[model samples]
Target: MTAQAYCPDPWTPTAGENARTSALVDRFVELEAQVARARAEQATLLVSLAEIAVEQGRRSGSESEYDFATRSIAAELGAAARIPEGTIRGRMADAVTLVTGFPATFAALQEGRISEPHTRVIVAAGERLDDDSRVEFEGIVVSRAEGVTVGQLRSFARAVAEKIDPVPLTVRQAEAMALRGAWVSPLEHGMAEHRMIGPAATIYAIHDRLTQAATKLKATARAAGEPDPRTLDHIRADVLADLTLTGTPTAGDGLDAIHATIQVTIPVDTITGIGDDAAFLTGYGPIDPDTARRLAGNAATWVRVWQHRDTGALLTVDSYTPTAAQRRFLTARDEHCRFPGCRQPARRCDTDHTIPHSHDGPTTVTNLAHLCQAHHRLKHHSPWRMRQGPDGEIEWTSPTGRTYAHKPTPMVRFDAEAEVLMPDLHLSDEPPPF
Candidate 1:
């Protein structure tokens, strides 16, 4: 009897195969950079065309004619590019800003150092900065754009621009607050995206409170070991519907007993009226210190957190209940989900053991982190691995052997003397009295 040898396809790549794949990836990235440069060239040309059109319109007649010329130029370009004229006009305005107001950022794009999104973020963040400040802002942001993701760059650009802006955030925020309103934009599948533009703190507080009530509903379901089909997001949406339509949340049990809570980190000096440093709002970037003070004064409980003078790493907090203290520390440490670029607020996340408790992972502050339910499952069910350093930097490794290090956003503190003060909040928590 003769038997044929079995030969199966290779599941793992050889060294040479891996090298080829790496080279291909590098080439793909290079091509993307080239596309970005081409986009910059196109934007420059569009700006030139718009300028010429406006000049011609000015020579011919009135302001209405000039605007019409701009619109006509957009329509012409839109027809060529197969984009809507309205979109083309918006692009034209952005192009003008990029070419004229942000020359260095434009050059960075032209040289293929950054992409279109990066440029947009830089421009928008620096928009409130004056000419000299904008130039400085562009130079700093463009220099840092190469090594970071677009999201990271956006946060950095915004913080930097805020620090350097000539206008006080309080003044700008006041002006913006006047324009606050709510609107709805229709979407497909009988859906819509409800939008609101208002004070950042108030908006964040509203969301935080909603998330808290939703989380309570989820916890109640889990405690009963009942199979609830609705996810946290679904529950949040339903709760919002109940509150707005019926004036009370009727979606879950014991929601009336749940209290809405929000976390705000403010500097000691700022709270004491000594400094105007912006406070770090959880899940959002920065808010004016005055707002932070007001929020702190209105809270029902206060947690005093200490930090090193040189490094702003969290040192300690006055502890009460061990479980509650741990949750507070983790929430303060991980402002959002530990997953890279996931800004899901900590209040909506599960406190997960970096190393599973069943696997002898101790129930300690260093051993725990906050992860959204989706990512918590992903960590367990998938090939992704996480490791936390002593400094609270989390390093996540994928199945492909690539690692991503996510550092905790440094807490804004002057020294170990600061306290986040929360007095009794008289507002009702049931329907979110925002």
Candidate 2:
């Protein structure tokens, strides 16, 4: 037998011809333990350094030393290869000091609890404050962090802002506040359409543009009693145009055909007590656990199920029964989607049939699979399709219908250069350290 010829065993580890498989297992365990300790230490050091750097900036008046300290820490972190410079500075500022960086620094504020937005206000305000006042301001925030819940923290921030520097005090502020204490100056706004060429933008990006255009057209729409500046049909068409303008793989017959879809309307019952649609997990996107459980809870109650061996059992008004062996096969062969490059846990992935259940596929281990929601939808609706090849690789076909073979996820591969630095499990009590 050769490596890559068969998947490595979870319990039975076979090594070089004469070595005991158990020895390989022992080495693996030892290595795992070592990695755990290294990660824990790294997290502690990083957070501790952040705390120290913030203090030094406050107490050490020498601009040269502060600059040197910052440069040194940044350099050290960069060399580590895993730490992002923007992320590092932001963490330190939010968690320890309040001098530099914008959004990243805000993250430091929650320590681990609040959120990026909450910290942004503090950093934005700090920009206008003098060094002494800024540090004083940070001190107040740090004190509040010890006992503040999320709601209290937001309120406390308002109090802190008032204490440090209540709204710009000079002529610039008087002119900026045309509407009194109601809003930030309109001058602060800027339009950002990062990909104007593309037809598809995020709902967040779309919302911003809509806000800008809405304000510009607000008076006319309101006078006419129109609900929106633009009609829904216009928006949808424009959005499609947006995606097309942005470089989607429109040239390919493979799934760049965004216009296609398969609508599967399985009749749903009011799941015991839940009001929300119970989501079927396809892969690792964010769906609630209650949704995952709903399908399972009502599995037996499904009077008629459309059993697709590879995709798992789906209950419609139609029905069928599985042999006892098939049930055991489902439990053993498929815990989740077998798609490479995905880790949503087995339970969260859809149980797919290796062969089409509609084509009289057998309910056997070799005929089962699990795909997460994203991939599942792609399989059924998009131009993308899946097929088990002769070599055992699950080939994914694109919109153009070209098949791309996805290798299994390298879950076990941890190169020395690729490991994530450990997060501080314990240490600073500030912000909460998300």
Candidate 3:
């Protein structure tokens, strides 16, 4: 037998050891400086690597400098770095901004007087100012960096940038409005965050409406001698979600028409209480079985999809009108865009024929896939090649002949009872006009 590996116990201060605790605290202070220096070194390396990528791009005459830098760094660093390529590119750009525009701020960061977050705040605001104005803005921000918190630093920098901006306030407002949109981010505890960027006045009005409804509901609960269980913030969030989903304050018996269609696929066994399998929310991944059943009960329409049990391959997609029902089937199968790394939901994407319809490709389930607008254009304009497998898997070939396969992540977890429930589910013979 091989020798057993030795694992050391984690270091911890003994109780009542004031000297050890003080020494540990002092060491930590020294480590903070070490960490800052390490971070500065890493930034320098990243800058050098990005410069090398630019030189390589010039020599190869193939990929752009940015594409080369992002792909190269992401590939070399791997996912353990926990930084996305876009973030890496953005940080490299910020590093340049700091070194060129705010030397004092960068020096403070290197010396551990200020942090990377502080540097980022300065760089972000300074980028908006003219060269002459940026120097003045940097002077104001860097002086306060060591003393102020990151949040305060951001606020101060923003204030300085606004005061020093060369563009007229109206023009800047127009530019800011052009950037408005909704963004989704993953959060802890199996939840996700939704952020909307828009006019402050419009947002405030919506918030006021939600607050009014929440307050009224709270008062109603109190008058009825019932506990006001949810907090004001929670009630407001629910109200916002309810309005956004159903386009009304109250969601009625069935799901209402909205901007995007939500599709949920649940095993018949779970729906009928035979099994506890979770349902797949088209773009959002798996939700609890109870939520699935509740949503299904309120669905305006449903399309039944059939697939092979063993391989999870599409068996026979229902033959329907080449419009609504067809879209439902594809959305159920693909869940999101067929692009290699994209997660844009099918509802917001365009269904494109894998083979060009101009070349006589039929508009059928086997020949169709959902692609976000950006990827759809890329498919047509770029040299990226695509092919569909017999089982609806997508194979993408990049311009450099690198091939990647994309298969939809299935929502169902297999159990022996799945076979028993299969015959009773998703077998609707009716295909009414939608």
Candidate 4:
């Protein structure tokens, strides 16, 4: 046991009766901190040992680190502790990280400035690099320490992962991985199938609903039956249970599309003007009433109807007062992200107000259009704005304040009586004369 193990925590504790309660609480916190430190050190030591083990393996005919850590830590802790070989190696792997991370991590822990998750992250980082590889990592962490606190180092590491053997963690990395993960691929595929076959649903939302519905089926099965019949395990259970569990997929044929959901932030005065039954139109063209407000009885994401002056056409929007329905409607009508050849689906695009709402841009069809998150950020972070004309054409102003005209959509109509083209196929239109 170390001296730090007896140190007190700074949190103002609960009300207690005994005089020793304060000291007890402090000691308990100290013990927990010490345990945390021990876990981290164990991990760090393991990392250094792994380096040693790897070197030894090269020298002694490909021996594993598992053998080395067991022999090493056991001698230090003693045989009576009867530590398992894997446990010691795991601990040493943990220790290897503390070689660099300990100073910053311990400092944060002692000061109670960081969450346990953060400390564990550094510990894990060290283990990944180990001893021989860690010096480079130490440099990276030190170089990254400032922004690394925000976990951006992981993001940065992940962005250029091919250069590093063990890729770092980051939001972008997670998203890419999510798209590639086996389960997510099927989920996205299912959503795509639904989009093409059933309705124009937000792919992400459809996956979520399917996952939820699947989970509910699983829970229901578990509650009612034993031996989850679906399993091929030794213990025989209800086979019907497993079949019943994957509910959402079975019900998918009957599923309806949940169109666009936009988050609206606006002033109260603007909402009063849009009368009740203010339904926001989803991107795929379904409208939802003020149910959020009706359910909570507090104002939220109120919908608005924007009537075009010349066209007499109405588009819905979501704002603190304005709705994004018009934004959704415009994006789908345009096809793809309006950014030249972006190819990102219409549903994923962010409906950006060409004139920022802060500048009093109305949530009308012409004022709203979709851009993917990257371009939406570009529009804000860069000096850019988008303008829509009555012809439904969008003009984009670049960061340099230079404007580019986006070409109009090509018109096509089926001519049933026209001569067909293609050797074995036809597009149901007349071919242009050669």
Give the top-scoring candidate (TM-score): 1
Error of 1 at 374 (Å): 4.5
Best by lDDT: 1
Ranking by lDDT: 1, 3, 4, 2
- Tens digits of per-residue lDDT, candidate 2, 1-434, equal 11111111123223352254445655875665455444434445666887566568768888777766766686678668677777766555554333333323333432443333445555654566666676677666644543333333443454454346634333332353363332233333573223232111123234434333333344445666874556644544444455558744332323233322110111233233333322221211112224333434534332222335444432222222334334323322332345544544343345565554555554443344557666665555544456663223466644333445543221111221111111111111011211
How well is each residue in 305-416 modelled by candidate 1, as lDDT tens digits? 6544554443333331225545655666776788887877676666766755545555655556778767776676655667877667778865456677776755434345
Q: By TM-score, is 2 or 3 better?
A: 3
Model 4 per-residue lDDT at 255: 30
Better-scoring candidate (lDDT), 3 or 4:
3
**Which RMSD does model 1 reach against the true structure?**
9.0
Would you estimate the TM-scores of all the predictions?
0.76, 0.29, 0.44, 0.31
Candidate 4 residue-wise lDDT, 1-434, digit = tens: 10011111223323442336546766876776676566555554556656765666567663565465446654555444577655665555555545444565555544444444555654554545445455454444433333223343332232222123343223223344445422222355444211222222233334434443444445466776742443322111222223237532342322323222322212123233343222212222211223323322343333332335556334545552333344423533443456654544445455555565556665565555557667665555544556776545677754333455553222111111111110111111111221
lDDT of 4: 0.41
The weakest ten consecutive residues by lDDT in model 3 span 420-429
Q: Give the runs in model 3 whose Cα sits over 4 Å from its true position.
A: 1-34, 61-66, 79-87, 182-194, 204-233, 242-434
Candidate lDDT (C-alpha), each: 0.72, 0.41, 0.61, 0.41
Better model by TM-score: candidate 3 vs candidate 4? 3
Between prediction 1 and prediction 2, the one with superior TM-score is 1
